[model samples]
Each structure stands twice: as structure tokens, then as C-alpha cells.
Target: MTVEVQLLGGTANQGRVHRVGNTVRRPLRPTSAAAHALLRHLEEVGFDGAPRVLGVDEAGREVLSYVPGQAVTAPPPCWGLTDEALRSVGRLVRRFHDATADFDPSPYQWSPQVPAPFGDGGIAHNDLNLDNVVFRGGTAIALIDFDLAGPGTPVWDVAAAARLWAPLRDPSDVTDVRRGRELHRLRQFVDAYGLDAEGRAAFLPALRDSHRWMRDIVREGAADGVPGFAAYWTAEAEARAERARAWFESAADEITNAVT
Candidate 1:
């Protein structure tokens, strides 16, 4: 999905992101452009956990405040998915929600003209894809990609994170090789987030809805002819999604039983 590369001599992890520099970086819809800016605003206003927007670069590629660290997409086999890590992620998101509480919608805020699937509230980084998060020193520190940020519900945002970390996706999709363990991970994350009985009980089911909705939108992107999304949704994605469906079904019982 990375189309271009340039050396900006800043972040070590992502290695110089704004390569297009003052030119059309890649084929993007206008809203994508606005997202970059919105993320910048959030950073300026104390939402520093995510990438900072550095304005359009030399070639007009969006220059972002690159976060330097590791984004653990999957927990390693030897590495246990610790409660600490889950809590760190929860705290990071909580900070973001709080920071953006007073953020005004510049450039029409998140989801400008297009109606977002989620409601408006704190700038929700609806896309909590594993790769979008940055972890340093054993704690979740920063998040990137405000591309999906918009007026969305706290439940929707939390559900999105759970879908990845609780991993509402298929069990097989979990690279950690843990079968029913992710259920525990879900509990850890929810507990970290300070959710009450209502939020905890509703977590997995809400995540289920997010899972179905998120994938459908990705599929929709393919149908609508978005390049990167289309490539994914075309062939392998379909089968992968099926497996995810099965995996989630297999874990449904544990999800129902788990307590945060």
C-alpha cells in the first residue's frame, strides 16, 4: 500500500513517510487529504499520541509527525499478551478521546461532507488497525492514521480496537497462535479502559457489529474501485474473511463468558 518513499531524516520506525513532497503523493480521495490535516490539529492540541501533521510536503504529499517505535501487529509466540500492554492501549485511547473533546472541526472535521457510519463525538480514530498503533518501552504510546477519525461513538471506536486486539476477527487470523486466549486479552483491554458492567457486557457484541460493518466497508471499497482496498477484497480477502467468521464463531462462547 506504500506507493512512494522519501528520506525525511526523522522517525526511525517508518523511515521518512512524506515521500511525495509537495506533489500529489498517491492516488487519494480528497477526504484522505483532510484526514492528514485533522491529525495534525489533534497533535497540536495535546493529542500527541498519534502522528502530527506537518502540512503538505514539498511534492504535496502529506507530511506527518512520524512516531518512532514498533507497532506490534501480533504478539510473538514467546511473548505473552500481557495485561500491561492491553491497559497501555486503553489508556492511550482514553487520552486521545479526552484530548479531542474540545477539538473543532477544521476542514469540516472528520467525515466532512460524507456521512460517517459512526456518530460524531471525540475524534475517533475508527481505524485501530494493529499497524496504526505505536508501542515503545512495553507500553502503547502513540497512534497514527487519522484517516478514519471522525464523529463516531466511543463504543464504535472501542469496538474497533477490540476487533483487532480482542481481535473480534477469526481465531486463525490471530498470529499469536493462541486459541481461546484472546478472550482473556479482551477482558484485559476492557478492564484497562475502565468500562462498567454495561460496557463490558456489551463489548463483544458491539465488536461483532463493528467487525461486520468494517469488513463490509472494505468490501464496498473494492466494489467502488478503490485501488488498495480492491486488491485486498478481490481474492484472498474473501477466504480470509470466511475463516475469520468461523474463528469468531468458535470463540463466541468464551466471549460470552469472559469478565473484565
Candidate 2:
């Protein structure tokens, strides 16, 4: 009944990661055929940029291929925040977008529809926090943690990625010493992704709204009994949310003009 290995690592939000022999099972997530179908479609028609579906584990957890490479955790030295790394992440994301452009929409993660005052991006890994991105050769070559993947706008995903990589945090949390350089990274990312006029135009507000939207979900997950989520709300989560919302508000014109 049992035959495998178990390893531990960080998750995008807060969850358990277990390696059972040759496969990985992410806690409290689904391994639906639809999800597998999406992964397969990405492999077949689009970019082969995602982890492989390995069915369910013995404990009925979502099983995925144990993707290799380093996840970019924070407290990074300045080099880890290099322009080249940012550009690589941007390019990889663009490739992912291009790869999945032809996907048929159905059976997605999270809600199938996004609400007003906030435009949602299409099917994507969605969470680009440093932890979810995989680095190789000093570049983010792959992505993990598709818990938030779903139907939405490329704008939302781009903005969210920009928030994490371009950062969009208050200057204080921008602690890599190369501080104040995130704007340049932001520009590089948008340029690499080739977000057009409309896409860019939609970015600023989408970015701002998405922060609150995401916080709402995280807190909701906590409220709904998702383990570990509560820890976030009680910690830097509130401060980060405040910082991001404030920064986004203050930088509204600049972000809007940049994306425009």
C-alpha cells in the first residue's frame, strides 16, 4: 500500500508539499481529469511548460511530477533581483501565455468567472510570488503552484506577476539594496511579454484590484478552513496588503502611463 519518499518544501500560499516516492501530492487541492486535461493540452498543443499530472496519490492527494530547479525564495541578495532574471521570468511567462493560447476553457481552478471592478486573466499559474517560480541558470525557467489557475485575463496574470517580480511592494520591503530598481524590472517584464496598448491600459487597476481580490481569497480560504492560510492574515499579509494597495494607489498614474 505504501512505497515512496516524502520531501518537504514551501508552497505558494501556505500548504503541505509531500513527495511520495516518485510523485508529489499537494494538500487540499484537486487532481481532476479536467486539470489533467489542461496539463495535457498544454503539453500537446501549447507550451510544454507545466508539471506533468501523475494522477492521485494513495492518500487521495493531487499528484504531480516532481519538477526540478530552485524556487526563488526571498531575502535575496541584489544579484537574485537582476534585470536578466526578471527578463527571463517575463519571457518564460510570455512563452506560457503563447503556449496556452489555444486552450479550451472548462474545469478550471477557483471560480469560473471574475467579478466586476476587477478583470480576471485567463488560465495561468496566476501566482508569481518568488516562491512559486523556479530558477535555473539564474533565470525563472519554470513555474509551480497552479492552485489559483483559472479562466481570466492575461492582464490580471501579468499584473500579478509584475506585482511579485516587478514587486509593487512598498519601498521598505524592496530590501535587496538595489532598491527602487523594481520599476525597471517592471518595464522589462511588460516589454518581454509584449503586452499591447489595451493590455497595458488594463494593468494598473487590475493589479491594484487583484491584490485586494487575492487577499480576500486568501483570508476566505483561511476562514473556510484551509490550513496555514490563517497564519498569513495574522502576519505580514495585512501589512503587505496595505503597502501594495497604498503603493498602487500612489503609483496609479505612473503604472497606468507605463502600461498605456
Candidate 3:
């Protein structure tokens, strides 16, 4: 196969990702081994929404199946910011959670787990932001960028996904038609995920935690000078995080009432 490389663009992680043929080549990180094992497990369970982890290449980069679709990124296009799209992501995350239910993470070293409640049992995609989800024809088709995958609960994963998709943020900061539908979308997401009473009850706090967890991650990456993260940190990431926190604070009760 021709080895011509194409760089993937985004303002999140620092890794260099390239596309060659139907495969994605990414720089290996400390958590790569655990991520590989998790991908293999997902394949073993017949979950096709995640990429297949093909071992490393000659250059020492971790190779993975290139999921062919458009990745919805920051300032996502209009199609990616719809209510239907939000619900579809909810179902996709649920499927990922269910498929990972039987997998164990004790055998491999992973990135540090997110803080409590989220840091419990089960392997979560951890970072399910819109940028990590690949969509085709406006539907979520696959998940990518598993660098943050590690031990966590399904509810925690859902919260992370919701914070990005439902987008727990102030109306002024939100860029799409979803500005005023935050609570409405939260209800839609929880309903689509089929959360139980307990999960519903825990949703708000998890949402709060997820928001802060992401901020800390960005701060660390920026301090360490990890590529894209540092740029984001210097720009609007922290301010956005604070604004999101404030919005969630005011909207939490309404979200809880709707979820339960």
C-alpha cells in the first residue's frame, strides 16, 4: 500500500494522526497498550463501532482501522448540531457501554482514571466529545481517539458525551441552534440511553464532574506542552470551562427534574 500520509486536524490532543489507505496511524502514548487491548475486546464482542487495533507499524506508530466518515469537531457543522444527532450519539454511547460490560482493565496499564464516581468499574471511552465520533449521513457511525479510555462507569461516559453533545454551556457560548435547548437535549439523551432511576439521579453530579475533569486534563496537557491542548488552553478553553460550569450550576436543577 502507498504510504502517503495525510495529517488529521483538531484542537484537542497533541498526537500526530495520519491516514494511509484504510488505516489510521497515530503516535503511541503510555495508554496505547490498554487502548489496543480494549479495541481487541470490542472486536471480540462484535462491536463494529470502534476501530480495529492493528499492532504497531515499522515506524513505531500504533496502527488502527481508519473509520471512514466525517468527524464532528469544535464549531461543528450544522448537521452535527441537531437534536436527532444528539439522540443518535446517546444510543451509540449506550451500545459502546453495553459492549464493554464484560471487558476487564486490570491486565494493562492505562492513563490515570478520571476522578470518583466516574473512576469506578467498567472501561469507558472517557472522551466521547463530538470530535471523537464519526458520522455518515448525519448519523453517528463510530468512535475514535481512545487515548483517554480507562476505568469508568457508563453513567460517567454518558455524562461526558452529554456535556459535549447536549453541550452543558451558557447560551452565548454555544454556537448553534442548541443554545436554548440544553435541558431539552439532556432529557432526550437520558431517555435515549434508557437510564434507570439511579442513573438519572446521578446524572447532574456526573455532568458537573465530567466538565471539571475535562478542564483539568486540558490544563495538564497545556502545561506539559502537548500540541493542540496547549493552544486551546491559552485560548478559550478555561474560560469556556468556567462558563459551562456556571451554566450547569443554574441549569442543574432543571436537568435533574427532567431526567428523573
Question: What are the per-residue Cα lDDT tens digits for candidate 2 across 1-260?
Answer: 65555443353334467666666777654435556777777778746557887777657678888777676665564555788888888888888877767776654545434445343345656677777777777877777776666666777778888988877778887766446876777888899888888888778877877777778877787787766666557657788778878888887877776656
**CA RMSD of all predictions:** 5.5, 2.8, 1.6
Give the clashing pairs for model 2: 4-21, 5-21, 47-99, 120-152, 120-153, 121-152, 121-153, 122-152, 122-153
lDDT of candidate 3 over 21-74, digit per residue (tens): 989888888888899999999999999999999889989999899888887865
lDDT of 1 by residue, 1-260 (tens): 54565433211123434444323232234576567656666767866687665555445555555577766643441222456766788888888777777766655634432234446545677777766777777788898656556766566677678767765666656665445667777777776776667656665666666677767778887787766577667567788877776766776777767754
How do the predictions measure up, each by TM-score? Answer: 0.76, 0.87, 0.94
lDDT, residue 258, model 2: 63
The TM-score that candidate 3 achieves is 0.94
Location of the lowest summed lDDT over 10 successive residues in candidate 1:
7-16
Of 1 and 2, the candidate ahead on lDDT is: 2
Best by TM-score: 3
How many clashes (backbone N, Cα, C below 3 Å) per candidate?
14, 9, 0
lDDT score, residue 181, model 3?
85
Return the top candidate by lDDT. Answer: 3
Off by over 4 Å in 3: 1-3, 7-15
Q: What is the lDDT of residue 206 in candidate 2?
A: 73
lDDT of 1 at 108: 65
Alpha-carbon shift of residue 219 in model 2 (angstroms): 1.6
